[model samples]
Target: MKKAAIIGGGVIGGGWAARFLLNGWNVSVFDPDPEAERKIGEVLANARAALPALSDIPMPPEGELSFAQSLTEAVEGSDYIQESVSERLELKHRVFAQIQQSCPDTLIGSSTSGFKPSQLQEGAANPAMIFVAHPFNPVYLLPLAEVVPSAASDPEAIERAKEILREIGMFPLHVRKEIDAHIADRFLEAVWREALWLVKDGVATTEEIDEAIRMGFGLRWGQMGLFETYRVAGGEAGMKHFMAQFGPCLSWPWTKLMDVPEFNDELVDLIAGQSDAQSGHHTIRELERIRDGNLIGFLRALKERNWGAGKVLREHDERRRVAFHAAPASGAPLVMAEMQVLPGWIDYNGHMTESRYLFAASETSDAFLRLIGADMDYVAGGFSYYTAETHILHLGEAKLGHRLTGTLQVLAADDKRLHVFIRIQRGAEVVASVEQMLLHVDMQAGKTCPAASSVLDRLMPIAAAHAALPRPDGAGRAVGQRKS
Candidate 1:
């Protein structure tokens, strides 16, 4: 297992820890704060409830998480290190010094939103390994990580860093040139300044400003982003037309873009008072959960269309699926799919819904079919396995957040027919079992036909191996039959 060291355990640090841990990387966190463990634990809880829902395939088994007593202890033998300490440059430089003392060559990433890569590299023993990997809040859910490397940085190391970020389900935006606050935050600082000015001028309340964004342009920005959204706004004329129409507004003083509001207590009280009235009912953790859920919904919608960040998610799932199948099969029944009972998979009584059990079985069988070369590509070629009959028996209960595994045992196989038994289990106890009979069919002819030799070559061996094992107890059970 790959190991990562997190230098701080604040919100962003905890988030980075959760992201790495969930992606199957062992993480060591070193934070001087007394409550860091509790805080990070809470963050991990929220991540457990939220992150798996965004994935269709099962996530890798969570990696080992450890709290280190010292910075050197955390960085030792770590494959990656992320520093999310206070934004003070001296503090960051000191942290880097301490980190280099232990793991001098490990890629060190600073979660500094405003500092340029060059600024971070100053006074470093090895500057090239230290780059900015600024991530948004709730890092486990948000995929964007701005990777800013300076001219002195090693190009190969930066590429490796981006690959590591991608392996953990992040979109590493390589900012070719490092600037203050990187890319996203620069736009954010502009909007933030405008919002502060609006509040200071008494033009809009906090709630109204939030509504304007979330109800309007915020939704647009979530998917298409600024340029693409405006390009669409340009209609047939495109971005050039958009510039011709709205470009003149750049000169017009419609609002204050370059003005600084007084940083007095009065302005602070005004913004704080309105924000309290807006959403102060929920605690910070509660607000985080709400934000995460909303993001998941928006992202899932995009995923269904395979557009925007959803494409990233889909690609991540496909990568995991490929890795999951690449393992060599053994003589035992194949472990086909690993899944978690997501929030949507539960019903009123808190048990996994009936449909999901079948869905789980399908996930298992589909994987097995893919293993035997009957995947979507093969189906597109006008020949595929079609389930002729299925008998399901629910033996136990699976609840929300429960991890389930789908294992398949092939009972019989021929050129045109396959008989199999699948068990969906929560660890050792089987919660459900499905027995299916499938026939190879030619899609154009819509009739049963022999499977390809390539597929049969893969299937028959597994079938023969499984045939040597004892038949499952419920292999041929009839529906509603009395226990005998």
Candidate 2:
């Protein structure tokens, strides 16, 4: 197992810990604050509830998490180290000094929002190993990580750093030239400055400003981003028309980009009071859950379309799927799919709904079909397996966030027909089981047909292997049948 050292346990550090741990990296955290454990525990709880829902395939087994007493203990022998201490340059340098004392060659990533890579590498024993890996808030959910490297930094180490970030499901934006506040934050600061001016001038309340973004351009930005959204606004003429139409407005007095509101008490109270009036009823954690739920919905919609950040999520799922299927089939039932009970999968009774149980079974069976070369490519060639009948038994409850394993056992198989038993399990317990009969069909003819040789060649062996196993009790049972 790979090891990661998190040299802080505040919000970002805890998020880093959660992301690495969920991706199956053993993480050791070092934070001097007394409440770090409690704080990180809460973050982990929230991460556990949200992260798995973003994935269609099962996640890797969670890695072990440990809290180290000293920074040296945490960094020792770690493959990667992320420092998320307070945004004080001196404190970061101190932390870096201590970290290098133990593992000088290990890559040390700083969660600094404003510091350039050169700034971070100052006074370092091994400057090449240190770089800016700034992540947005809720590092476990958002995928973007600004990976800034200086001229002094090693190219090989930077590339390796990016791969590590990708392994934990992050999109590493390599900033070729480092600048103050990096990329996303600079845009955010502009919007924030304008938002502050709006409130100060009594133009809009906090709730109104939030509604403007969440209900308007925020949606566009989430999908197509800034330039593409404007390109669409350009219509047939594209970016040229867009610039010709709005280029002169750059000199207009619409935004106070170069100006700043005085950071005085009155301004703080105005924003804080409006924010409190807007959302003070819910705690911070409650707000985080609400935000995460909304993000999941938006991201899942994008994933369905394979656009924007959703594309990153889909690619990560595909990577995991490849790894999950890498092992050769054992003699037992093939574990075809791994999934989690997402928030939407549950009903009012707080258990996984009936339709989702079938969905899970379909996911499992679809995986098995793909294993036998009857995937989308095969279907696109005017042939595919169509489910003819299905029977599902609800053996137990699967609640939200429960990890599920879908296993398939071939009961029978022939050129044109397949009979299979599938189990949806939560750990060792079978929460549900599905028995299905499928027929291979030629799509153009609308009639059952024999499967292609390539598919049957793979399927027949698995069928022969499973034929020796005892028949599942749930198989061949009619509805309302008594247990025998």
Candidate 3:
């Protein structure tokens, strides 16, 4: 198994550990704090709950996580070393030196928010092996990891680092040239500065400012960043129109960018008080869960739209689905779709909503399309299967985070029609069943057409294999009360 060594156990380091550990990389951590193990364990628990909710494929079994007594022991055999020590330069230099002494060739990534890679590499034995890998808080869920390499760094090592980060489900943004604060943080710092000024001047309360974001641009920025969101605002005229309309505002006295207020106790207390009034009801852990739940729903929505981070998540899910469930052996189900019930799938009654069952069943039909060569490429070729009718029965309740498996059984098939049955279960119990009738259609003609010979060949074997099995319990049951 691959191994990663983490030299700090603070929030950022713990997040890095969770990302690597959950991705099936063994992790060894070293921190002098007595509570490091307990703290990291808590973070890992949150990660376990949230990360898997974002994808249909389950995460690999977590790798072994152990806390080492010293930094040298952690770095001794690690393939990658991530130093997340305090932001002080001297401490980072000392940690880098210690890492170099133990494993001279291993690439080291510093989780420094402000310092450039060159600054972190100042006193390292091999500057080529050091780079900045800055990740936002809650790293396991958020996909962005800014990878900034200095002039002295090895190009090959940078590429390798990107590969490693991607393997753990991160969108590694390579900073072309080294600069202080990197990209995301620069915009964040400006926003943060403005927010402080607003709070100080009584222009807006902290809650109102937060509401403005979560209710307004935060949703847009989550899927499309500032440029694309503004581009849409430009309408048919496009970005040029947007620039001409808004460019003059750059010189307006609208922002306090040049200076910031002092961090005196009064300012600190006022900000803290307002923030507490805004969100003090929940503990940090509860808030983290809520944030993660919202993020998963938003990302999944974006996946449907095939935009921004959702696109990243969709690609990851496809790769994972292909990896986990390869075209099965001879006797397996004709098609399958796997997923965990997310928070949004639940109703006010605290169980999965009725509409979601139909959605999940439809997913099985989609999987069947992939099985018989009616995928997106094949559909683009002007022929596809369209569902003609669907009948479904809900047998039991599925709560949030319940693991679900839906399997397709082909009951009958003809030249242009397919009769299918679906069974959905959680553990050993059946939760739902669906019956669907699908018709093959020619796109240009918009009429029923026989499936291609290749698809028929694939479908025949599955129909033949399932033909011998005992009929399902709800195979032909009608949706009405029998006379009693």
Candidate 4:
């Protein structure tokens, strides 16, 4: 089983643990926080549902998780270690010092959004082993994680960390230099400082500024980053023209990056009070759920386009292909009466999920039916077929994360009914089979009826074409035998 260790059981640490665990890595957490167990438990519950929902690709069974008694126990024999303690330099240094002694072989990483490996690893025993693996909040939902390494870090360390991050749905950008805030955070800090100044000087309320960003370009920023957005703004004139148009504004005294804003008590409350009014209704978990939903939708949209951030989505698609155990649907034909369990359709017993078995059988029959022209639009009008009864025999366990293929052939069909058999196979082995009896129904009226003349005419030819295929061994299986 894959395994990793997480230090500091805070929000970031819990996020890291959740990401790894959902992707089938056993994670041990070494946080001394009194509430760490409760917090991590909450994170994992959301994680289990969130992670699987993000991908249709079958995620392997998740590994075991344990909270460690000490830092050394967490790191012992682990493949990777993420240090997400508080943001203090001394605290991180102390943690790193302990981590180095405990697990020298483990690649040490920090979840520091505003600090570099050089700063975090200032006096560490093996600074090369330490690097920055900055993950955004809700790490499992958002795939972007910047991986920055210090000068002393080894090349192998980078490669190992990259492999682990990719396994857990993170897109890691390896930065060569160790800047103050790595790469992404610098841009965020610039914006953060300006936002601070806005609140400090009373230019805008927190909610207004937030609305300005969200309703405006921040909405556009998810699919396209700032530069790409500017490129679009450049239009056919291109980047040069776009740069010429807005570049001069850099000199304007609009941002507070260079200017400092004092963080006095009154100023903190002014911003806090504004923010509270803005989002006081929702809890952090509720806000996270909202954010996760939006990010999942955004990522799926990008995945559709196969451009911009969609490139990361495409890479994920490729990874899914590798990790997917399902048999190729188009490349080969399944034999009649043989079982072809689908990866996405099995329960713990390895037998197919009951509804999904019918689903698979129905899917195969639907494909045969569609060649005849009775499809979604045709069904939507007034008439479509419905499975009145289904008989399924699960021969063996179709364990989780296994590939399944289905063979579908029509046995007999007339204007009113379809006689179809579906067999699910795992590799060369037959695992389950379903025989379905479907009735043409007036879907709007919710009752059986004669098939539509237009649809039946088209479907008759294909059903005739497939009818000649000989039935597999279980053709006339008794309903009781199919109950297995």
What clash count does candidate 4 reach?
A: 12
Q: Give stretches of model 2 more than 4 Å off.
A: 340-343, 346-351, 399-403, 449-469
Q: What is the C-alpha lDDT of each candidate?
A: 0.91, 0.92, 0.86, 0.75
**What's the TM-score of each model vs. the native?**
0.93, 0.94, 0.84, 0.70
Clashes of 3: 0
Sorted by TM-score (best first), the order is 2, 1, 3, 4
* RMSD per model, one decimal: 2.2, 2.0, 3.8, 11.2
Model 3 accuracy (lDDT, Cα): 0.86
Mind giving the per-residue lDDT tens digits that candidate 4 earns over 1-484? 8788999887788889998887788999998888999999988876664555444334566789999999989998898889888889999988889888877667988898878787887888888889999988887677778899877788898998998788777889998787887787888888888998888888899999899998999888877788888999999998999999999998997666887698799988999999999899999988876676566667667776776655765576457545332333222233322222334456776656778766656655665455455666787687878887777877755664454656766677888898777777776676777778889888777878888787676656656766566666677788666432
Residue-level lDDT tens digits of model 1 in 1-484:
9999999999999999999999999999999999999999999998887787677667788999999999999999999999999999999999998898877799999999999989989989999899999999889998999999999899999999999999999999999998999999989989999999988888999999999999999999999999999999999989999999999988888877788898999999999999999999999988988898788888889988999999989888878878755655557988777777767899999999999999999988987898788988899999999999999999999998787889999999999999999999999999999999999999999999999998998898888888888989887888888645
Q: For residues 78-172, could you state the per-residue lDDT of candidate 2 as single tens digits?
A: 99999999999999999998888889899999999999989988999999999999998789999999999999999999999999999999999
Ranking by lDDT: 2, 1, 3, 4
Looking at model 2, the pairs that clash are 58-338
* Displacement of the residue 125 alpha carbon in candidate 1, Å: 0.7
